[model samples]
Target: MSNRRDVWITGIGLVSSLGEGPEAHMQALSSGTAPVVDATGFAPYVVHPLAPISFDAQIPKKGDQRQMEPWQRIGTYAAGLALDSAGIKGNKDILGTTDMVVAAGGGERDQSVDGAILTEIESQPNPEIFLNEQLQSNLRPTLFLAQLSNLLAGNISIVHGVTGSSRTFMGEESSGTDAVRIGWSRIAAGTSEIALVGGAYNAERRDMLLLFALKRLAMHAPWAPVLAQPRGVPTGSAGAFLVLESPEHATARGAKPIAKLSGVWSERAQRNEPGAVEAVIEALINQARGDVTEGTAILSAASGAPEPTAAEVAVLARSGLPVRSITDRVGHGLEAQMPVALAIAALAVSQGSLFAPLEGEPLEKPFTETLSRAIVTGVGHWRGEGVALVERAD
Candidate 1:
């Protein structure tokens, strides 16, 4: 097998509070404008930066939007933008012939139903029976059809007719990058020339919020954390997708290659394990290139979680690359982690500026004298760890 086949990201679609497209989002990030705001919709959790897409406010088609899950709606919205960016029409014939892969960090359907249940209980008096009955009837299908991580993939497949090959991964946060690695490997193995890869997630449910709080993945509120204690995953919903094609395929189609998805490195550092995270980053640098350690930017997976973020900071102090977490703008979601990383990396290549993490204060002391390299880490509950080290082409 060829060690590497030219895999280039020719097109990108993004849904974040900053903006809908890559350029717009990058501009917002570079300008130091925060898109975070109060959370709305059915999600009751305290959210600092609610990155809802512009489409969320618009009215959906009769019956169409009514039945669709929140994640599906986000995915559909991202899919449209991604395909349009590539100038590829979402036709059955076009999709049917191309090999495709869909993956997510989290499922959105269950959360939407959870939101519905909470809404019902709030609106009704003595809502236990009423909520149960509604859940039994209306929420069951969402549980059956929408809960699985692959539902959105099925929905996309039906919409576009992408029949060549398919697979889905829910590595929590790392799932999106894992899907990209798998797709890249497939293309390298001569399995498929083209692949549509990205991730979508919605944390818009009351139960999901409470669960995250229990797990210490997010905070209930700024005051709750500042006064009481820190807990839970930061609430967020996002959809980001990319069109990856081999050089020959893109060249034949007259598509401009945005940047080569040259290399990907993933590591899993359990709270109980030692050296797991460092080993992964070291391996990534070695595998990427013999000289990759010199002045490369790292698209980091530094979600707002304190422990993992600290772990990453320690690793960076040792590794020699400047670090940044892009999750500060869109807020962080597990499933969307890697896809979001990929999207920001794509923007870095296009905009000619390396993006930095928005959450933490810049290091008081320098990790190294030379700040040429940036590390983008994908941190979340699932162990789909990813680190991208990139250098400018001469």
Candidate 2:
């Protein structure tokens, strides 16, 4: 829309249970080995089928860890990987020459912890005396400060010394894509030369999964029994970042461009709007000149279940591009949704291939036929707010 300036992905950083590096992640996705495991890091939190992640013990000890929530760590760590991948080492001189942005969402605390706290309060002696008026109320301010969403952006900037234009969002699954939009805008507008854009989420809590199951939004695909739920958000943890810059800027600096940020389009779905989903699909195709008529493939956002997957299928059926689902293997990491999704999109663009979800044998259904140049769709339940998104192949 803004003269269509050329933008390229020069770097990518990912920290997921599947494996930290790009090649390793790609291998895991291809092999169908889901990094998701039952919650063990915080076993005291629950007993159920959870997507667990083995934390890197090598992470340095800092006072921030004492106060920062797990998601902040994920954000900082993920940002570091993207900077390392981009070859940007926090130099003021370098950042001064580029603009940057951080995209994220799910600032809401998973209410599942409230039940556990209430249980703990029950065991207190003279529970009424200690908990009646409100110990939690007194501690609310401290807890609120610890989980502020902007803290993630602040942590990332501190890690990488990115003193440039910054942007943050809270659109859950669409957060990363929206962040990319900001980065693309900065470079195209000549405000900055390069930008770091992505998302992160720390959802290892069992209550997070239980909450989604309550909403019937949890993974309920007939085949993904382990991840199935009747409602609420699926629990997941992931951090990823992408280095974006104008094609001319990257080439001038001799950066190996991974993929071009070609086109992006989104449409918000209304409550029970019959054609709301298709409306977003049409918007994407129209933006891409009626399906990038010459585009190669599509990267789908469906998270390996029937309802969301079926919704994506119908959208792609209209777009006329092959649709592929990455979540079947990546697991559902919410806010980290597009950061991981777009990062994989960059990889496939460079390799000239589209990746597919791993075979579940009993439950996995292949979307390979439709995922060649696919449309990635994500359905989120942060209270009736859902989104549809599409990204083009390089």
- Strongest candidate by lDDT: 1
| TM-score of each prediction | 0.80, 0.78
| After superposition, candidate 2 runs with Cα above 4 Å error | 32-61, 96-98, 106-117, 120-129, 132-138, 142-147, 220-234, 289-295, 303-309, 360-375, 379-394
Candidate 2 positional error at 303, Å: 4.5
Alpha-carbon lDDT of model 2: 0.59
For candidate 2, write residues 4-76 as lDDT tens digits: 6777778888876666758877776766554454444444221223224333431355665555567777777
Residue 52 accuracy (lDDT) in model 2: 40
Model 2 TM-score, all chains together: 0.78
Off by over 4 Å in 1: 39-63, 91-93, 105-147, 223-232, 293-295, 356-360, 364-375, 389-394
Kindly give the stretch of ten consecutive residues in candidate 1 with the minimal lDDT sum: 223-232
Q: What is the lDDT of residue 13 in candidate 2?
A: 82
